[model samples]
Target: MTTGIGQEREKNMEYDLGAEVAEWMLSQTGAPDGARSTTTLMGLQWDVFPGVWHPNPGTRLFTSWLPIADGCRLLEVGCAAGVTCVVAARGGCTRVVGVDIYPAATDNTRRNAARHGVAGRVEALTSDLFAELDEDDVFDVICSNPPLVKAPESRRIDTATEQMVYDPGYELHRRFFREVGPHLADDGRIYMLTSETLADPAELRKLAAEAGFTGRVHASEAIGIPAPVMGSTPAVVAAADEHGVVRVDFTMLEFQRG
Candidate 1:
């Protein structure tokens, strides 16, 4: 079922909408290419890497709804800028592990952890999902604000930046559910961030069910973002905001092994 945005995002389904939004956001901030920079989010300063996904509204919403507890072990997959990892560490998690496919992203997490004085509680690893994690490494809390936009392989740009936006057939989402059970403590909880503007919640539920997990919407909110409009190129830029903005429905899905 859809909320907030309704059918607005479906208007530009043929275009690479995820990349368009990212480009518009980057252009608005004038972030230099291939350079490291710092920005503050969730009231904490974060060191952002060139190709890493910067924390956005969805990221913030997920963190706000995250179920972290003191002394619990936490794991954040696709921890681009390590925002969630640092947040968990500061929240009193005994150990917070942040994993990403990009080495630069892992380094960026380390930098942010150090900058925030949580280095002692955080470990940054370069990994694709749980590949590098030990089979016995389990956590009380496992969370990921993964790439939600659904696009075909042919349409994907395949950069680290784009990887943060497009899931390309929901392969990553499928893998996440299929692989997560073994790494979660019996009482562990899993949280995933998704949006109606970018994905089909029903399909996600099917994937989760296939992997033996029961899921529910833990939290949801409506957020406005730049609308996509027909242009010379397929990209819907931030400039389109002058025309109007579209409301995107963001949701945090809670899952437990069935």
Candidate 2:
């Protein structure tokens, strides 16, 4: 009888561990704040939280420049949880489609959109960008905050695998530009953001030109970490000296479809 009881306890413990692992995975994707969230951005009340894609600083820059009028169709690629989708909906876009490789992320987006009463205005899908999208499906605006950082060789996955977030290479941005042109309406525009470390402005502009896009620099900013607090390594100090800046610089490139 004691042996049977011990076996039952072990099973219970295993069940608990499995539950914990599931919860942790969910948290890593994004933490939902119940069904809704209230956040303050630039002194304005904004809705955001877990299951919603958190707008990175680059997204914010593009959002600020958006021509928020009725009847605009917006597409956001790599939209994890759809924070930017909600923002676009709130900004008066008639239709917003957010695509990601992860079904859970899209599911989060759907829930968050419903929470904000914008579910009708937003659609989240698991798609490989152009793969699932109809050839003729075009948008007024397209935006993305792609995973631009290259992973170390040891952790690299098969190149042929379709992932929601994976580093293709420095030239992935070039390919994105090439592919986007065909899907953009004549008057359509694209807002893309990536770090200087990942892509240079000149190279991006050239790629856009090849893709039949007229590119312009919309905004640039230096992301800084306090030097004293960031212990000085030789490389860090050298970078600071060269740029006369201790901050990582980022540029927002806007492309207009001609």
Candidate 3:
């Protein structure tokens, strides 16, 4: 039996611990000015900038799994350094558009596309979700590996880099589902990646349903998180086992109009 006062205290402690571990995970990224680094994926050289959402296991996995067909138009939301954008263009996608809220990320995407000689087929734009996209713009395949954390009000996110990690109240995701349909062509599909270690996939599906979209888990694979941060993050604690091994799963969810 717990009193209301005791429950409040426990909640506060959880928030504090989650914040502490979140800061540690972010520090590992060399963020804010993720000074230029390069990595090879999908057989192409891509320059990674830290201020943007640089390629992580989630991004890499999403890129490889996206269904990009020859001559299909593709749009990638939160297209951090354009890993998927470049791959789509080189994979024979007729047009690839990558949008990010950070100008630096969009710039980085442009640079990488040009680096791989796919600039002619790739366009990078600085847009907050679908805000900057033209109403008539439609894509055959729309994909996003969005921020997985449902940031609580206790956490302070002051930079674009922080925005890449925390989606406060899931406002960004709500906006995505509500606005995405118009941008998708007929017979098109949406691909979004979620992680059990970061957020609730069920909640995401609920949001999609509220927006009149049907979603299903298209793929799922277990992945590991750094062991040390497991206990402090309350949101992801249930994802770990008795041995303190984090049993995280990266789930790819597909959506279409109901």
Runs off by more than 4 Å, candidate 3: 1-25, 225-245
Better of 1 and 2 by lDDT: 1
Highest lDDT: which candidate? 3
lDDT of 2 by residue, 135-202 (tens): 88889988887754433335455322212233545456666787776677788889877555433457
Please state the error at residue 137 of candidate 2 in Å.
Answer: 1.6
Clashing residue pairs in candidate 3 are 34-50
Estimated TM-score for each candidate: 0.83, 0.67, 0.83
lDDT of 3 by residue, 1-258 (tens): 989999998666555544554565566455664477887666667787767665766677898888878989999998888889999998999989999988878998999989989999999999888888899999999999887777875767887667777888888899899889899998899999886556668889999999988999988887566556544365446434676655556899999988
Cα RMSD, each candidate:
4.6, 15.1, 4.1
Indicate the worst ten consecutive residues by lDDT in candidate 1: 230-239
**For model 3, what is the C-alpha lDDT against the true structure?**
0.81
Report lDDT (CA) for all predictions.
0.78, 0.63, 0.81
